[model samples]
Target: MTAASRPVALITGATRGIGRAIASELARTHHVIIGGRSRAAVDAVVAELGDASAFVADLAELSSIADRAAMLPELDVLVHSAGLIGPHEPIAEVNVDDLLQVFTVNVAAVHELTRITLPGLRARSGSVITINSGSGFTSHPNSSVYSASKFALRAWSDALRDEERAHGVRVTSIHPGRVATDMQQELRAMEGGEYREDDYLTPAAVAQAVRLAVETPRGGNIDELQIRPQ
Candidate 1:
């Protein structure tokens, strides 16, 4: 099928982890656009997923995001999987720079990208799925900054859902428990413990949640989904 005729999905952080899995899953039915910081990495994933394209953009860099968003004509699905896990320090020890950086990527970027893409999404009656974390609803020791960013994300998703419902767009926040991705490995290492893959959910599992939200009927909106390891 020609690219113009197929449904299009743009997945940020598509180079690895849950983003990559979502890209792969959507590629079966949609023309996936792989969004990532590294062109080489995006290209590699595109090569792996035959029916996909690449749009390289670093969420941390604000200037280029607008330009990249303009390149997209219309988008059917916008999956926000690009995020940062800030320093795991107690509130007393948390660095201001670290907090700002985490919020910039996890919150601001998501908001701006959605804003820029709103027209296209509204035109297509699309779906927006954000990969929020279980930390969004609860906080643990030394996780204040990360949790705060996620809480902000949750608020954004909620507001967006209400605002876009009249336009026939679906907004969903997916809060997944610890996923056995490289990020989890890093978190485990920071805690000075062994990283066990079996202890967490796979990226594919999280990707399935995204697919379910996207595939729901236009009249049905799955606003929030929380998946945890059994």
Candidate 2:
């Protein structure tokens, strides 16, 4: 397909890790739009993908989302890959500011972006992919805050899936376990555990799951995909 006719995919947090892997994978079939907080990082990925472009904005800054979403009048796929893993601590000691920060980026931002882009997605009968985590289903001892955000994200995705089905739009939530990304590295550090790269799932593996969800036949939809390392 020619450039103008190709499907458009916008992947937030596309600067590195799972987001970058997803952008690269989709670039082969779609004109990828890389989204991230750093213009340089997004541009570098765009340069590497060749057929891709950049959308630089901080998801934490919710007010900027509307204008950024405006720039994309047509979007075939929206991937909510950007997230924040706030300080892992017990709920008793968690600061309100940190809780708000985590929820604002992980839940609120995702909702706003999806809301703004629903029309474009519905127009094309497109898909929305949420790069969720195992925490959404099961929260650990000191992971209450981060896990809460993921749980909320999962709930939103579930609600959106049913709400938009009649509109011919597909919504999917992908829950990946222990991916070997920078986030995992930081998580390991926080827990004072050894960083074992080989023991974790690769970013590309998670990206492939996303591709499958986005490419599923029109009549059928993948509500959620749970991926874990054997």
Candidate 3:
């Protein structure tokens, strides 16, 4: 099929892990735009994906998003996978800078991206999927900052779903537990424990959930999907 005829999907954080997996899955039939902060990393993933392009922009820098958004003529699927897991510390010990940084990327960026892409999404009745975390539902000790950001993300997705449903845009929030990614390694290291891949969900598993939501019937919307490791 010609590129113009194929649907376009933009996946942030496509440099590695779950984002990369989702990009790969969508590239089977869609024109994938691999979004990442690092040009080198984005280029490498695009090279490996064969039928994909690169979108290098820092989500924390809101100004850059508009510039990148202008380059997208039309978008059929938007997957928000870029996020930051800030320093794990007690609520009383949380630094204000860390909180701001985490929220900037996790919540603020997602909001802006969704806003900027709404028109394109509406034109095609596209799908908006945010890769949320299980922490969005429940918090744990020393996870306040990350959980707060995710909780805010979930709220945004919920509101967006309600507001955009009238315009034919489907918004979904996928909450996955303990994905086996570099971020998981960092979390385990912070707790002075071993990182066991066997105990965590694979990135491909989360990608499958994204594919399912994106490929749902035209009149159906999978608003929220929660995947936990058994």
Candidate 4:
């Protein structure tokens, strides 16, 4: 297919980890646009994927997100992969600021970006995928803050799928369990556990799950997928 004919995909947090893998996978079939906080990092990924481009901005900033998203004339696929996981503490120890930072990046940004891109997605009968976590379905002892954000994300994705069904826009939430990324390593250290790559799922595996959801035939939608390490 020509450049104009190929599907367009914009993946956030694509400079590293699962987002990077997803970008690489979609670059095979879509004109992947790498989104990240660092211009250099986004540019690097764009170079890595010869057919890809860049969308650099801090997702926590709604105005920047609006400005960046407006540049796109149309989008076929939008993958929300950027997230923040932190303040692993009990409710008593957690503060509103911690909730604010986590929720801003994980929930609010996804909501904002999707809101701005709905027109493009509707125009193209596109798909939206949110890289959620198993924590979304269940809350752990000290990770309630992160879990809360993921839970909210899951709820939003569900509503989005329903709201956009008539517009021919598919929404999917992929809940992964402990992927072997830098974030997982940090989470392990925080939990006082040894970080073992062998025990965790690979980013490529998660990417494959995303590919499956986006590639599903148009007559159907993969509303939610939960992937865990075997």
Give the per-residue lDDT of model 2 (tens digit) for 30-75: 9998999998899899999998887888999998888888878578
TM-score of each: 0.97, 0.98, 0.97, 0.97
TM-score of 3: 0.97
Model 4 TM-score, all chains together: 0.97
In model 4, what is the error at residue 193, expressed in angstroms?
0.8
Candidate 2, after superposition: displacement of residue 162 in Å? 0.3
lDDT of 1 by residue, 1-230 (tens): 12456899999999999999999999999999999999999999999998788889889877789888878868899999999999988899998999999999999999888899899899999999999999999999988999999999999999999999999899999999999999999999877899989999999999999999999987999999999999
Off by over 4 Å in 4: 1-3
Each model's lDDT comes to 0.93, 0.93, 0.92, 0.92
Scored by lDDT, model 2 comes in at: 0.93
lDDT of 4 by residue, 41-152 (tens): 9999989899888788898888999998888658999999999997988999999997899999999999999999899899999999999999999999999999999999
Judge candidate 4 at residue 158 and give its lDDT: 95
Cα lDDT tens digits for candidate 3, 152-227: 9999999999999899999999999999999999999988899989999999999999999998998999999999
Model 2 steric clash pairs:
none
Clashing pairs in 1: none
